[model samples]
Target: MNRPLYALLIAAAMLSGCVTINIYFPAAAAEKAADRIIDEVWQLKKEQGAKPEGNQP
Candidate 1:
């Protein structure tokens, strides 16, 4: 019983060491999203017949 418990503890420790976590950020995708938002805002402005702020028409 003692031997089995020790083996199990060792195995658990080894498995814990093998765990990994990863995070990813895609800059290009973020830039594309920003561009889409700007385009939509421009379209909304056009539909409302209002010039965007700070722009000469």
Candidate 2:
């Protein structure tokens, strides 16, 4: 019983070490995303301004 438990613990430790965590931060991609967000907000503002106010049906 003790032997099997030791083997399982060792195996779990080895497997955990094999995992890799990758972090990416791309400046160009971030800039493009920000530009797209700004563009969408500007578009919404334009559409809102082009519409008539005070609920005319």
Candidate 3:
């Protein structure tokens, strides 16, 4: 009975290291997506040629 319990504990400990999780995302793709979202949310208009109302010189 002790041998079986010891074997089971060893098996569990060996299998624990085999589990893995990895996640990856491309930086360029994320930046492009963020730019598109910001443009949509702020309603950037380039074709209108209207001066932006701001304190910007």
Using TM-score as the measure, the top candidate is 3
Clashes of 1: 0
Q: Candidate 2, residues 1-57: lDDT per residue as tens digits?
A: 699999999999877765532244666567656756886987634344433334534
What lDDT score is found at residue 19 in candidate 2? 55
Candidate 2 residue runs with Cα over 4 Å from true position: 1-21, 44-57
Candidate 3's TM-score reads: 0.37
Provide the global lDDT of candidate 3 against the true structure. 0.63
Residue 18 lDDT in model 2? Answer: 59
What's the TM-score of each model vs. the native? 0.35, 0.35, 0.37
lDDT of 3 by residue, 1-57 (tens): 599999999998777645431234556557667766877899974555343333344
Give the residue spans of candidate 3 off by over 4 A: 1-22, 46-57
* Alpha-carbon lDDT, every model: 0.62, 0.63, 0.63
Error of 1 at 25 (Å): 1.0
Positional deviation of 26 in candidate 3, in angstroms? 0.9
Clashing pairs in model 1?
Answer: none
